[model samples]
Target: MSTDSMERTLERTRRRFIRRQRTQRWLRWRAILAVAVALLLVAGAVWTVFFSSLLAVQAVDVEGTSLLSPAQVRSAAAITPGDPLARVDLARIEGRLMALAPVKDVEVTREWPDRILIVVSERVAVAAVPVGSGFKGIDADGVLFRDFAAQPKNLPLIVLPDDIGQDAMKEGADVIAALPTELQARIDHVEVESVDGISLVLDDEKVVVWGSAERSADKARVLDALLNAAPRASTYDVSAPGQPTTSD
Candidate 1:
């Protein structure tokens, strides 16, 4: 080959190599810049969620509260405004609300940018127990929650012995819960002597011998049928539900 031709070919090859090197260097810098930008975005998001006031708590909303007021729920939650929402302890807030007697279950959650939500499930009273001058409300679970100035007409009175155990109170509550709605409305009070000796006194002075909490559903069904069949009966024995008896 001629020297001039060889020199021209060599110059072209050198220029091509320089261009490729420049392109490769630019591609590597682009990747590095992309990764850096992504890292900066992640760091900024973390700061906003964990430390910045932009995502801090501004309000606490309460839901499913009936026995307790919204103010009571908020006070129990004790979440401070301006605290980072993402950093708020939901489990801790729930624990605090559960400490209240009327609260059966509670769930605390963050409502995004700046709000907290506390949902409470309050206990429903099934019976009222005479306590001093007032009456204490007992739920179906036998948990004593609130107090009434006087016995609520809607709830049946529960007469438990002074030394009655929780089991007896729970048994009485269970018996009342098992009764049909129609029969429950006729109930005046329940006398619980022991776990196995629970009785229901109807509004008309009729007595229902409900032996124990066991097989209460069966007993409730039998008693309902007996009441319909012998409407004039004064006492009903449904301890053995399969063979119930009624006496006037």
Candidate 2:
């Protein structure tokens, strides 16, 4: 081949190589730009959820608050307005509301957009004890939660021994809760010296020897039959329900 022709072919090859290098560099820069753009979009989405006011809380709705007012629950929750809904601490809110004595269970939830909902369950009282000028009500779990100036209806007075331990209190409350409504209404008070020594005093001055919370349903059925058969009995013993007795 002639020297000039060979030089021209070499020159064409050099030009093609330079063009390929430029194309590879352009593709690498384009890929880096795309990754940077994706990272920025993800950061923006996170900021919107955690810090932006678009999803901030504006109202609090409370449900199942028969014993506690809505205002009381909201105050206990201590949720700040204008905070992002995703940033609210639900477990912390539940803990604060459950600290109240009457609250047995609580659920805190985020209602979409601009609201928080709190639902609560309060304990029910089955017995009462005099404290100062008021009566402190105790539930079946022996938790003293309610306070009233006068005796609450349908709740029996607690006459357990002085310094009665928690076991006696729990047993006495359970016994009182197990009585039928008709019999419970006729009872004036309950006395408990020990877990096994639970007794009920009727409004008519009749005495009921209730032994323990065990077999309470059987005892109640036996007592009902005895009271119906001997309505004038002064004392009724149902401790051994299978063999009940009455005394004049």
Candidate 3:
């Protein structure tokens, strides 16, 4: 081969190698630039969420509140305004709200941007018990929650001895809960002397002897049948549900 031909071929190979190196360098820098941009974007987002005022708490919204007012719930939550919403401890807020007497359960959540939401489940009153001149509400779990200046007309009165234990109150609550709705409406008060001694007093002053919480459904059924068969009877005994009796 001629020397000029060989030189031209070598020059073409060297130029090709230089072009390849340039392309590879450009690609490496492009990837680094992309990674740097992504990191900056992530850092900016973190700053906005954790330090900037744009995502700070400005309001606290309370929902699912009936027994407690919104202000009451917010007070219990104790979330400070202007704090970063992303930094709010939802579990701690929930624990604080659960300390309230009427609050059965609560959920705390971030509503994004500027608000915190607190959803509460309040205890429902199943009965009332005398306390001083007022009455205290009792839930189905026999937990005393709220107080009323006077006895609530809709809830049955639970008459328990001053020294009665929680078990007696629970038994009385169970007996009331087991009664059919029709019979429940007729109830005026529940007399609980002990866990095993529970009775229902109807509006007409008639007594339904319900011995204990055991077999409460059976007792309720038997009492319903007895009332239908002899509506005018004064005393209905269904403690032993299999053998019910009624006396005038």
In candidate 2, where is summed lDDT lowest over 10 consecutive residues?
Answer: 153-162
Per-residue CA lDDT of model 1 for 1-248, tens digit only, reads 99999999999999999999999999999999999999999999999999999999999999999889999899878889999999999988888999999999998888997999888899999889998899999998888999899999888899988899888889989988877788889888999999999988999999999899899888888888898999999999998888899999
TM-score of each: 0.89, 0.83, 0.87
Let me know the TM-score candidate 2 reaches against the reference structure.
0.83
Candidate numbers sorted by lDDT from highest down:
1, 3, 2
lDDT of each: 0.92, 0.91, 0.91
* Model 2, position 55: C-alpha lDDT score: 90
Q: What order do you get sorting by TM-score, best first?
A: 1, 3, 2
Candidate 3 TM-score to native: 0.87
Off by over 4 Å in 2: 1-23
Best by TM-score: 1
Model 1, poorest ten-residue lDDT window? 175-184
Candidate 3 least-lDDT 10 residues: 173-182
